[model samples]
Target: MHGPVSTAWSLVALCAATGAYCLLRMRSGVEEQRRAAGGEALMGFGMAVMAVPAAVYAPPRWAWPVYAAVFGAAALRALWSARAGAHHLHHAVGAAAMVYMSVAMAAAPTAHHAHGAPGVPPVTGALLVYFMGYVLLSGARLVPAAVPAAGTGSGGARARWGDRPELARACRLSMGIGMVAMLLAM
Candidate 1:
């Protein structure tokens, strides 16, 4: 029988779907924005793919390097772009978290446990933390909706942001649940 942890993996998959859908829905006239949207969508897909092996077995030592390269590139891009003050805060933090997790995963050895090792595998725990941070930043995208003034007939503002807040919320919840599962697995 499937354990509770498996359910969490399902949540992660759901989050990936929602995140990808949201990114696709956003309008991106600028080249950078377009790239960001595409990258975010790819991250969502990657997260889903990662969940499969994560759900089944502890991530192998090699997997960490792969994840590191992928997320490290993204973090560098986001940080470099941020120099121009073009990227959003969420993107910056998200990339930073990814970099941190990648490093942590890469540093994790895949052998006998250490004396002070976390209950969950180091790489798995790091992955969980990274994803949890992503979920938080992703959820932050919805904060603007909390202001009633912003909601007041500001069709233009709403249009500028693309998909509705409900959609963003759905994505956030999905990521949150997914992270929870990842943490449980760890």
Candidate 2:
């Protein structure tokens, strides 16, 4: 995303860390979580790369189109997966958002970061709204369910780090927030 150098680097760190966590999450025993984590890892790393400070290292122009192509393929894959389950639909949307950002960057690579851009694009606004809502929803889901404790016994050991659904939800929340930041900068 186009922004101050500090902001860019901050985004880079956040996204890269999220990506790394997603990679670890692929170790989850659940087939669905493992499958989802792989794609999310791609997104996290891709966002990190895109958030790089252009002032420090501007990519060649072709990079943007390549990004678009990659995320486009991701969107297709997510769409296919969505037929089996609804969570993949969110992945499809996220991938499509990445494609949109890539095209916008390609259109005016330097201008986006410059101070004198016009109003926010309509599509950007829509995307921002979607991601913001996702962040909120993901956060809400992170709270433990209200089921009564079973006889106050140690219910069960927490899931291992890689197997924790709460952590996965947190990951999605962080990415959703990052997407909002990236879109605002756009």
Candidate 3:
């Protein structure tokens, strides 16, 4: 693979490894932590597939529809679980983005269908920008901030920025940057 593709793959591997670690951590955590771990794992794996180099394996024509269908179902599930939290809404958006990317790939002419190619439509470019912003901001929000020692309760545990594990947050930030790079390559 070329430099850009190699970088993308490296990011993908990092994301996947982080996700796997989160899953492993889940074995001893609370219900919320377990849920977050599962979500991270799925996100990592899905992005890895999406971020794969086109030269290695562009999705077959039929696979595009399958990808759309799968992500569409995920979106529906997210919608149904909207009561869970804002994270579910994020999941819905991610699923929708995947569906959109699938359709865009399927609809593009074969000559221009390769990933990160110049012939991509304006809509895809717009989506990439939007996704880049969303992922970056979301990931940033996950980063933990230092709190005063006195702020801790009797248990003396430092508060986390959010429910997600630190590694998960790092994974997200990594993916966010990776997505930006992928968009720029387009």
Clashes of each: 0, 0, 0
Q: Which candidate tops TM-score?
A: 2
Model 1 vs. true fold: TM: 0.59
Model number with the top lDDT: 2
Give the worst 10-residue stretch by lDDT in candidate 2: 148-157
Least accurate stretch of 10 residues (summed lDDT) in model 1?
156-165
TM-score of every model versus the real structure: 0.59, 0.89, 0.71
Off by over 4 Å in 1: 1-4, 26-33, 53-61, 84-89, 103-112, 117-173, 176-185
Shift in Å, residue 45, candidate 3: 0.7
Tens-place lDDT digits, model 3, residues 16-39: 776566567566447766765666
Residue 182, model 1: Cα distance from true site in angstroms:
3.6
* TM-score of candidate 3 to 2 decimals: 0.71
Q: Report the lDDT tens digits of candidate 2 across residue range 3-110.
A: 788988899999999999999999888999899999999999999999998888888999999999999999999999999999999999999999999998898846
Return the lDDT, model 1, position 167.
61
Question: Candidate 3's error at 87, in angstroms?
Answer: 1.5
Instruction: Enumerate residue pairs that collide in model 2.
Output: none
Ranking by lDDT: 2, 3, 1
